[model samples]
Target: MEDHANSRHKKTVQPVAKARQEVYVLRDLKEYLGESLLIIFSVLLALVLTEFINKQHEKSQTKELLNNIKEELKKNKQAEQEQYVYQQGILKRIDSVLRDPGLQKKVLTDGTFHLDYLAPEGVSLHDLSRVAWQVAQSHDITPKLEFKLVEMLTDIYDQQARIDKIEDKEAAVFLNYESRKPENIRETLILMRDNYHGWAFDRAPALIKKYDAAIKEIDRDL
Candidate 1:
């Protein structure tokens, strides 16, 4: 009976020791998990800070680039304004010549402006065409503008044809004159060709392309 009691006590003690060991192991595992969690959170926080700093740096760079672009655009706009003013001055001078009584009667009324003023010297056909185009553009060309351009082109063509005949028939007349006259005619012809291309075609697409981006940006801003 004493031996049986000793055996039962030994069995109970073994279970108690096993439970104690399990409790110790659980405590150790909880500590390990807590340490792991802390490490993970710290790493995540550092990564978030790094990303925020990088984003801020990128935004600053973008703003700087935008400012530089704005400065360049401002300079270009000023230059364009100066050039436009100069061009207007030249047009005014041409208009004054055209308005003269003799010139008006011979060129404007008689429909010989291209021959008397433009084809002769000092004035250029390209300049004339550009002025006309600009005038039409400023006025926002419609059907009326189109009619004017067509009429202008036709009159200019007729005058040029007449001038070409005169050149072929009386080469000596041109040769005897100051070289400046013929040179002017040559330059005028080149200018006229470019004007024809621009007004009749070519330049419209370029203008459209120029405005397209600006319009889209405006729309985005809106």
Candidate 2:
């Protein structure tokens, strides 16, 4: 009877010991799962933070580019206005010459015509600023710019190019006239005056209006 009691006690204690071992194993598994979850969460958090930082940096860069472009456009508009004034003055001179037959006779006979009155030496063809546009293009910032802003810039530059070309042609005519004989000078002056009037009066003002609208839009956006 003593031996049998001892054996029964041993069996109960063995089952208890096995249950404790299983509990320890379950606790270890829980700890390992928690550690894995924490690692995953940390990596995800890091990736999200990096992405947000990159986006903020890009936005700042884009805004800076837009501001620079706005400044450039302002300068261009001022230049255009000055050019308009210069051209208008030339047109007035041409009108005075055309209206006075006496002045025409004197110019034809003396060959003492002033080409400066036709094309001012100080005024350049499209004296507009392009540094900002050039930098933006070189740095691939156009893609980041708003679609409408890009379109407006393109239009303004296209008009500038056209104006420059016309000015170049006028300059060429003046240079050719300068080297011509006195008898041929009158006709050349007439041609130069007509060309100047056409571009200055008709085309330039339209381009200036476009510039005004575009600048206003840029200001609003900024």
Cα-based TM-score, every candidate: 0.37, 0.70
What's model 2's lDDT at 195?
A: 72
Candidate 1's residue-wise lDDT over 136-173, tens digit each? 33443334223543344334333333323333332332
Segments of candidate 1 deviating more than 4 angstroms? 1-27, 89-222
RMSD per candidate (Å) reads: 17.7, 9.9
The CA lDDT of each predicted structure is: 0.41, 0.71
